[model samples]
Target chain A: MPSVKENTIVTTAAAVELRGLRKSYGEVVALANLDLSIEPGELIALLGPSGCGKTTALRTLAGFETTDEGKVLVDGDDITRLPANKRDMGMVFQAYSLFPNMTVLDNVSFGLRIRKANSAERTRRATELLELVGLPEHAARFPHQLSGGQQQRIALARALAIQPRVLLLDEPLSALDALVRVQLRDEIRRVQTELGITTLFVTHDQSEALSIADRVGVMYQGKLEQLAAPAELYSRPATAFVAEFVGTMNRLPGLMNGGTVTVAGRSLPVDGTAPASGSEVDVLVRPEAITLRPAEDGGGLIIATTFLGSVTRVRARLADGIEVSADLPSHQASALTAGTHVTLELDEQPVLVAAPLPR
Target chain B: MAQPVTARLGRGAAWAAFAAYFLVPMGASIYFTLFDRDNHFSATPYTGLFQASGFVPALQMSVEMGVLTVVVLLALLLPAMVTIQLSMPRLRPIVETLCTMPLVIPPIAFVAGIIALQTRLSDADPYGPLSQLVNNQLMQTGLPLLLVFSYVVLALPFAYRALDAGLRLLPLRTLVDAARGLGASWPTVLLRVIMPNLRTAILNAAILTLALVLGEFTLATLLGFTPFPVWIVTSGGDHAQQSTAASIVSLLVTWGGLLILSVFGDRRRTA
Candidate 1:
């Protein structure tokens, strides 16, 4: 096994900085003055829906696309005008971009060959990378002979073979099946940590980003809406878009008075920026934060119940015609079937509140 | 379980149609070539091929032309197609249309156009550089360079489709970018990476070009070039037996070559 500390000592990975990156196609903007800085040896995941500029940002950093306005710096060296071949960045695409004609070892050693490394050194390094990716025995196999997950692993090994200062992965696990996706996701994180390479991973799956990234950057409409650690991003979203995009958020009509918002006849202190007093706002609540109990005089009706292994989700319709879902322990939710009356209460945790939508 | 009566009849009819389409003509050709006037099978016609005048030279000329056509066609088309696909994808439809235009033009009309162009160029002022270049000894040789050019045009559609299909199966842009990112130059990427992956397509294109060159008659005949097909036709008027025998041999050779190519193409190594 390659020691993470030893690898880190051998090569100090470079920090990546993107300053005011802006790109557009005719009238439509893809990236709008996005600025971000990633630390050395840190893994940052840019998460967004399709066409949200996450891919555009990653490609710009990879030097595949020229930003209309921006400066890309690696270790404080300006690489904005550099061509892709000279940038020294390794990329693993969503599709299995392994050269189909070459065997696994050849694919991994392609960069070394391009760099004019002799045969013995290239083979040694390629063998080491294959072993790192847990496919040492598959060196002689062609790409088509491997399964999808195995092919992707080989692609990853090939990308890392170049010792790129910064690694870019564009939805590498999106093509994999669910079980293999999760398994490969953990495998990628393990390899990344073991190498201590600065990586920028672009993906649309929220759980994938949250589970793998040191910091998750939620993007919306060509802008970074919120960039925070996974736990902070999930619990305390900085914007309404981030709150809704990251996880299941139930929007409840509330009135903001002073620093508190009133929802479901209960007052709760707001966490982030709140609207002025006496303004209507939408209070964002997570399902697990809402507690439910069976009551004869309940204000909500349990309209549906779904068993989700460890937790059962119950959808309840309030008297005001607003429906909300609450997750409960499977054993406790056994009695809360559809058509049962249930009273709802909010926990005392600080909640995020957004300004009311335009009428 | 036994097959239904109607199903068996349908299968039998299909087999009969296949046999009629393929075996009958082949058997007749063989019969004509092998049997002498006494109606007894003999190999005299096959032996007569060696004694026929101009047979060996014409056959050699056609083989050389076929090989040259394949080389020139690949050299011209592959780079042009790769460049177009990489940088100028908007021009793909126009290029494809232009490549298939030869199929629309009859062979006679195409040869007439080439003859007219050659005449116009040859009749130009002798002192002019273009005229001097065209009137050179190399151009005056009876090597039928014009036939090779025409064969390349005729083979374009097949070559294009084979290469286009192969390129479509690959993520060309991504592959190029990946190679470039790994510090490989454009030439390196094309030769080492892209060309290896396109082995089957290249083989198919080359075989198609070779077949087109070998069997083409109108252009060669009208141009007064005695290539293999022209030789075969001219010999048919005098030595019918040798001509039929040569045709059968050529047909089998082409089919055998294609079969071998396909086998090589399919024999991809497993882990």
Candidate 2:
């Protein structure tokens, strides 16, 4: 049986840094003074909406785009002005970037051939990459003959064949369906971890970013709002945008006081910076942090229930005409049905609070 | 169940009609070429092509013009089209308009404009550099380069449609970026990556240009040149049987060549 290469070349990874990156197209700025630094062998996911400059940052680092003012450094060497062909980066696009005219083997070995590797060496390396990607018998098939997922795997193998300086993924999984997307993402993560290559993954899917990245950078309006560990980013967002964008956050009216906020007669410390005291704020609470129980005299009435595999979501309306949603274990939520009166209990986790909207 | 009998009959009728429309003229041409003056079967008209005056030279001239037109057209249009689609996308409509302008104006009008310009230039300065360049070098060459230029324009609508369809089937920007990121230079990317994928489309363009160049009569004749079509028409005055036979032979040759090429292209693609 063909197997993964016994000796995959292990090269030392480089630290990548982007400083004061600025880009604008006529009136609209695509990237502001954005700056980022990545440690060697680390994978950072840039997460944002479309046109939020995540892709622009990745492209600029790949030397595909010229920034108005910026410096791209790899291991402290400035490479901002290098052409894409000279950057030695490997990229997997959204999908369908495979050269349709080439067989899978030819596609994989193309980079090595460009570097003037000998024939046997190219074939052996290409075969190893194909084996690494778990499609050992597919070397002779053209790209169009493969399934979409298979095509992407071959594309991944092609990218890694050269052991490129850095790996850049530009929404590579967005073209796939949900099941294939998750599977390929896990495959990508495993391969990236095994290779110990520095990577920049740009995606609009928050779950994809949160599940696979060492750190996730949230961007908005051409700015990096925050870059933090996935857990920290989800639990304690630096901005309201980050809080709402990363995960589902239920907004409840609260009164801010010093470093704490009061919501529905209960008090909790703020997750990040709190607004000035004695002002109304929007308290962002995670669904998992809220507990619900049936009580006739409770202040909230159960309005609906939704089954989500092991977790069930319960929506309730308070006496003051505010609605809240909570996610709880399915066993615990069996009794929480529509028209049941429930008393809500908040966990001890600090809650993020956003400034109140203008009246 | 198999296809319905009525549906089969409808398909049969469609094929019969198509065959009749396509084969009637072919059969008639064969009949005309095979019969001699004594009403006996002979291959003289077909074999007599080699002996016919102006036949070989006109054929050679047309073939040369067709080959040059395909080369120059592809060289100019491929990079230009790719650039317009990739970086200068905002200029797409302008380029498309310029490429397809020949389709709007009559070929006669286009040739008239060319001839008028040459006339005006030659009249203004009989021995000037501009007149000499236009008259002697460009038009009066051993085989006129002007016909090749005109054929490229005449074939534009067809070549553009072919190439555009092929390009639409591709994720052009993504492929280019991926190839560049893999360390292929721009020329390497174009030749090895993009052009190879465009093989069938390019052949389609080349065939269209060849057909246009070989069959074009108005531009060559109006500009005072006698290419294949003009020779064919002029030969009809003295040698009508040979002229008709040559038409049939040329049609068969073109179709046979295209069939071979398509088969060859398909084998390469599958391999």
Q: Candidate 1: which pairs clash?
A: none
Error of 1 at B92 (Å): 3.1
Candidate 2 stretches greater than 4 Å from native: A1-5, A357-359, B2-6, B119-134
How many residue pairs clash in model 1?
0
Tens digits of lDDT, candidate 2, A76-179: 99999989989888899986898988999999999999999999999988988888788989999999799888998999999899888899999999989999
Q: Model 1: per-residue lDDT, tens digit, B147-209?
A: 787788999999999999888877888888888888788789899888888888999899988
Badly placed stretches (over 4 Å) of model 1 are A1-12, A307-311, A329-335, A357-359, B1-13, B39-45, B48-51, B83-90, B135-142, B269-271
* Cα TM-score per model: 0.92, 0.95
Best by lDDT: 2
lDDT of each: 0.88, 0.89
Docking class of 2: medium
Tens digits of lDDT, candidate 1, A94-157: 9888888899999999998988899998998888888888898999989888999999899888
Model 2 has a DockQ score of: 0.79
Each model's fnat?
0.75, 0.92
The positional error of residue B155 in candidate 2, measured at the CA in angstroms, is 1.6
